[model samples]
Target: MTQQTAPCAVTERVIGIIAEVLDIPPHTITPETRVLRDLETESIDLLEFGVGLNAAFGIPVADDTVFLTSLRVHLEEARHADADPYKMMAGRYPHLSCDRVACILRTLDDGPVLSVQDIADYVLHALRAGQHEKAPSHAG
Candidate 1:
């Protein structure tokens, strides 16, 4: 199945940020691009990415929300704790589809999959959530 691209204002900006951090052409980056695996990014790159995104989007991405920096750790922890790893991953990465989460869990030994779309999704989610939090409140 071909993954449909989710092109948007936020997505384009994310790609630009990623390309800059990775020192690659923006055209090479796509929603399906895997940051860690495909881009060969290190932990420092992720930190720079988090900073870049925050600077560009004004959204807090320090937590494992936008990026699945601790995917393996979380999964292992869930297994050790006798918890449903799927449920935990789905909860933490609500931006990703359940199918994607399942796929990530299945091939986790190969590597964690954190796509650009996932990052864009979390940015959009955070922006929407922030808007709601700042909305006019009748209870105020």
Candidate 2:
């Protein structure tokens, strides 16, 4: 696939992994589908999904990176520091779109609202970052 299509491939792969792990119909899973809400997934399902992502992409799926597991703590820190929650969250989760972070923050009580797109973005980020790290340096 070309560079333009790599993201689409990753998104589709993530959706497939989620559907397989959750035993849900792949047709029901979309980029905007919420893992917690729409998929009605539990903790074990998420764990297995993370494992699937790791195996499929050959990259370490850090809990925070893919799942945003520490979102509560991050929110607390951002509030304690009197920082802009949106900016803090955006920096913490570079893969998440700004609108997504805003939506999550708006529903602070409901906690982080992660979508399939976020997971795919994290996968793409991990893939690109891994490539950069593995690339041989020409500078001496």
Candidate achieving the largest TM-score: 2
Q: What RMSD does model 1 have?
A: 6.9
List the pairs of residues colliding in candidate 2: none
- Span of 10 residues, lowest total lDDT, candidate 2: 129-138
Compared with the true structure, what per-residue lDDT tens digits does model 2 show for residues 47-118? 998888777777777777678888989889989999988888788898787877778778767644788998
Report the Cα RMSD per candidate: 6.9, 5.9
lDDT of 2: 0.81
lDDT of 1 by residue, 18-74 (tens): 899889999998988888888978888888888887776677775576778778788
TM-score of each: 0.81, 0.83
Which residue pairs overlap in candidate 1's backbone?
none
Cα distance off (Å), candidate 2, residue 42:
0.7
lDDT top scorer: 2
